[model samples]
Target: MIIAKIALELTDLLVCAGVFLVGSVISFFLFHVALRRKREKLISEAEAEAEVLRKEKILQAKEKFFQLKAEHEKYIGEKNNKITQSENR
Candidate 1:
């Protein structure tokens, strides 16, 4: 009778342990999936921000180029005017 009781108790313990292990595995899988999704979201946000910054920098560079070109043209015109005045005199 004692041997039978002991065997029954052991069987119950094994079943409980199996259930706990399965639950842990499922929990771990769910956590991993959540983490991956969060990471992807962060990466997407960063890429969008970077694209905006790149476009802004390009616009600023174009503005700078235009300003420099205007200055150069003004300088050349002034020199030409001075030469024409000297020729007239």
Candidate 2:
């Protein structure tokens, strides 16, 4: 009878240990999947932000170029006017 009781206890302990190991493995897998998804989301958001910044910088550069072009054209017009006035005099 004592031997039978010892065997039963050993079996219960092994079952509990097996359950604990399986639970741990499942938990690890779930956490790994969640973290991977979060990482992907962060990477996508960063890429989108970079694209927006690139577009804004391009627009600002174009605006600056147009402003400079207008200034140059005005300067040339003023010089032409001066030449015409001197010729008429």
lDDT computed for candidate 2: 1.00
**The candidate that achieves the highest TM-score relative to the unseen native structure:** 2
After superposition, candidate 1 runs with Cα above 4 Å error: none
Q: Give the TM-score (vs. native) of candidate 2.
A: 0.88
lDDT digits (tens) for residues 53-84 of candidate 1: 99999999999999999999999999999999
Task: Show the lowest summed lDDT stretch of 10 residues, model 2.
Answer: 4-13
Question: Cα RMSD to native, each candidate?
Answer: 1.4, 1.3
| Candidate 2 structure quality by residue, lDDT tens digits, 21-64 | 99999999999999999999999999999999999999999999
| Minimal lDDT window, size 10, model 1 | 4-13
